[model samples]
Target: MFATRSEAGDRLAAELEGRGVEADVVLGIPRGALPVARPVADALEADLDVVVARKLGAPNNPELALGAVASDGSVWYNDALIDRLDVSDDYLEEIRAEEAQNAREKADRYRDSPGLPDLEGERVLVVDDGVATGATATACLRQVRAADADYVGLAVPVGSPQSVADLEAEADEVIALETPENFRAVGQFYREFGQVTDEEAIAYLEGLGGRS
Candidate 1:
């Protein structure tokens, strides 16, 4: 288990370098990922930025994500979950619209702009604390692709075996330090998994603190 997100980032960065992976840009999903992405950007000698997305929760079960939507309105839906839940198109549209705005606001907070940076012809890597259902990661990957990135990849410290396999179809490359079949949640593998406030999260971008 990772002692801290910073430690996870260091190991993840080393793994990426060991594999000779090159990234022109490293985009972290904000709040939890900034701490993880900082070292990766420094190691790769790439620019670091935020890629924001919000999960669309199931009706009356806000903790259950049916999908996620990016700041640019790019979305990834879990058809299996939606189908099993028997969710209607009307409910999906309603929640997507609401969450899309939330994602844009979050992106604006991170970058002081509403959309992603120009990634055309750039090698883009999306970093997160870890993958669960991979709903948000997929949305951000689609957003990067829509921006015409030359290459898109995802790297994480740990993830569920199933989610890692599913994300293969979403990016050019996928790397995980650990993918246990018995994984339950991303927090299970972390020794210090605390909720990151916006101020602390933005500090990673400002270069104030991250290694802690």
Candidate 2:
């Protein structure tokens, strides 16, 4: 296993090199993704940026993500989960509005623009620390697609096998370091699995020294 996020990102960048799909830019799913994406951007000699996605929580349990909303007002819902929870359509819309605003706020805090970078006719690699249900990743992918990227790829250090499969349908290419069968949570693979703060995320991006 990789020692840290930077190491994981470097290995992932090497994999991307092998595929011959050189990225024009690397987009991280903050705040957990920033550290990983920083190194990938450095390795690729490209710009590092954030693609903010706010979790759309269920009515009572705010931690339970029903879906995710992007900075550009794009929302992706877990239809199966919504059906299972019996969430009302009106309630979903309300939550989406709040989450969209939250994403925008976070984006503003992290960068001048929280939206996807210009991937027009460029290869774009979306990096996340890891994937769980991929609700947020789906939302991010939708935003990337909206930018009309010529190529779309996802690179993560580890992910649930099921989540990896789900993402493959959305991205043109998927490069994950490890896909464990007994996947529990993204944190299980990391020793330093702490939440990354907004300041830390922005500083990490700035330290990479270009396109920040």
Candidate 3:
């Protein structure tokens, strides 16, 4: 297991290099993935930025994600799960609008600006600390696609095998260091899985300047 998120980032960077993956830019999911994405962007000599997406949790069970909405209102839903839960269109629309605005606000906070990078025709690599259900990551991928990214890849330290498999259909490529069959959670794979503060996450992005 990795000692910390920074260590995980280092190893992930090396793995991407070893695989000869090239990216024009690296977009980290805010609050957790920025630290990991920083090193990868540095290693790849690519621009670093944030790609924000919020999970649309169930009505009663907020932890259970029905889908996710990105900053740009791009969405990815688990149709089978939503159908099984009998979630109404009105409810879905409500949550989507709420989460999309939340994502946009978070992205603005992280970037410290209202402007977003031009992603059209760029090779974008979306990074996260790890993937659990992949609902948010799927939304992030859809957002990147909506931005007209020529190629979109996902990079993570570890993830569940099933989640990785599901994400393969969303991303043009997936680079995960470990995909354990017995995966319980993303934190379980890290020895020091402390919460990353907003300040710290934004600092990583600030260090990248306007490269993105």
TM-score of 3: 0.95
**lDDT pick, better of 2 and 3:** 3
- List residue ranges in candidate 1 displaced over 4 A: none
Model 2: per-residue lDDT, tens digit, 39-126? 7887788788888888898888988899998988888888999999999999999989988988888888877754565789878889
Root-mean-square deviation (CA) per prediction? 0.8, 2.6, 2.9
Query: How well does candidate 1 score on lDDT at residue 43?
Result: 99
Leading candidate by TM-score: 1
Q: Report, for every candidate in turn, its global Cα lDDT versus the true structure.
A: 0.94, 0.83, 0.90
lDDT per residue, candidate 1, 84-182, as tens digits? 999999999999999999999888888865588989999999999999999999999999999999999999999989989999999999999999988
lDDT of 3 by residue, 105-201 (tens): 9989977566358989999999999999999999999989888999999999999999999999999999999999889999998888888888788
TM-score of each: 0.98, 0.92, 0.95
Candidate 3 has its poorest 10 consecutive residues by lDDT at 203-212
Give the distance in Å from residue 99's predicted Cα in candidate 1 to where it truly belongs: 0.3
Clash count in backbone of candidate 2: 0
Candidate 2's C-alpha runs over 4 A off are 208-212
Task: State residue 208's C-alpha deviation in candidate 3, in Å.
Answer: 8.7
In candidate 2, which residue pairs get closer than 3 Å at backbone N, Cα or C atoms, i.e. clash?
none
Instruction: Name the candidate, 1 or 3, with the larger TM-score value.
Output: 1
lDDT of 3 at 60: 95
